[model samples]
Target: MTKYVSCRHHSQSARSEHQGAVMEALEGGRENAIYRKGELVSRPASHWTMTVHQLLQHLHSHGFAACPKAVSIEGGKELLTFVEGETYNYPLEGPIGSLMALKSAAKLLRRFHDASESFLKLNTQDVHHWMLPSRSPKEVICHGDFMPYNVALEGDVVVGVFDFDTAHPAPRIWDIAFSVYGWAPFKTDEDDKMGTLEEQIRRAKIFCDAYGCTRLEREELVEVMTLRLTALVDHMRSMAANGDAQFQANMEDCHHTAYLQDIEYINKHHQAITLGVLGEIKF
Candidate 1:
């Protein structure tokens, strides 16, 4: 059975060290084991957590504060300082659907990528374990999943992002492609889609513009978006086949089918989207 856990983002209650803190569960697309306590969030730790923590530290050292601070790992749960702000899921509406939100998210993603570049250059990959395999050109550590729900917002502005479980080394476009897929949200799911294809393309252009995406990146955006979503579906099925209960449950609910449908939707409109985002034609 699929379980949905929602926890309050802010809390003021105090606790003694001897007393056990409350563990408020958090919900995400793939996992349900996350929990929040006062100012700290805890989730199941994987083999790659140390490497991810190193990346977080590197970002923090470079003066980037929009991501969670890796506190410590204990009893198989990785603890991170909670980013205090509102978070949202599907059916993007209100502030999350605003142009400002898209622009801020895009800019923030760019900042994150830029901040991570030095870390990528300083570290050797073979020594570190990552949940997802590193992609070529190793531009930055992709947040792996930078969906709306993963971001913390103050009004329409994206202030911080959490849940770094999927962070991996990949090209800028590899991450940007997936981020745009969620922010532009070329979703075919009834509950998740926001506007028409034209509207979506316009939003995509706004995002790429704010992030200052290269002409080359814009030219190849549509193909990358489709490829990214297809990779997600493949990963979902692969995890399910490998006995990951969360993924198996996701499969039961046909999440992979939803992604596949969206991939088709993007491909159907790829030309217009490519042209639209390229600013060559108005939709």
Candidate 2:
């Protein structure tokens, strides 16, 4: 049996250059470790710890108030204030609330992306780039995992965002694709608005319009969505093979399985969905 250490029992030790093991005690089965030094959470030599710290520092500097404040604990574990909000999983009873939530999320992403552009150019010491995609000239910071489950909503408004383990620098389009792929859900109708593809298309338009994306960019939605979906499938497979139970369960589910299997469907109907989203915009 795995030994469990209480959060209080863990002692703060000098920051080491070793990858710390995950503590299975945290809720949501978070892979965390205790660390000393820095008032914010720091995993001495862990890639995720470095990435999360970078993201938090960037957001805090830019006055992005939606992320958790990292706190350093006695042990190697870093404590992030728990965000309080419900996951925007099931569709809202009314379309207005859902629209509001998507709009808010887009605006937040826009702000984060814009701020990250400047940060990327700055040289910081002891920074280890982890999971960062090849940096393109047009690349900004990408929230590698910009799914609905990572976004917290309060009464139809996006309150906070969590999970920056995959944060990296990539093209602005990558960020847009990641968000839309999950929010619009290219292949599966699981997130279809009120149980219909038509409604899903309508909501997709609302999401794109709020983000102020150009028509050409919207047209490439299908292509970008496919790339994002394919990347996600591979990511899930990797996580499962590595013994991530949550990802394994998601991969085994029929809905998620269809989401992975039906990539061809989205590729085939990309134009139609693009037109539907474009038509909804009054410009």
Candidate 2 segments exceeding 4 Å error = 1-46, 73-76, 91-97, 124-127, 132-138, 185-194, 241-256, 280-283
In model 1, which runs have C-alpha deviations exceeding 4 angstroms?
1-20, 29-32
Q: Every model's Cα RMSD, please?
A: 3.3, 8.1
Task: Please report, in order, the local distance difference test score of every candidate based on alpha carbons.
Answer: 0.81, 0.60
Report lDDT (Cα) of residue 235, candidate 2: 69
Instruction: Report the poorest 10 consecutive residues by lDDT, candidate 1.
Output: 1-10
Candidate 2, residue 107: Cα displacement in angstroms equals 1.2
Model 2 lDDT per residue over 1-283, tens place? 0111112212222334445643322223233443223323343234456566766777788888787666543345456655556653433444324678878888878877777776777734326566544445545667776656567777788777766666777677777866765565543444442434566666677777777777776877777777866776776677779997767766666434565555776677666777787794322
The stretch of ten residues in a row with the least summed lDDT in candidate 2 is 1-10
Clashing pairs in 2: 11-74, 12-74, 33-76, 33-77, 34-75, 34-76, 34-77, 35-75, 35-76, 35-77
Model 1 — TM-score against the truth? 0.92
- Of the candidates shown, which would achieve the greatest lDDT relative to the real structure? 1
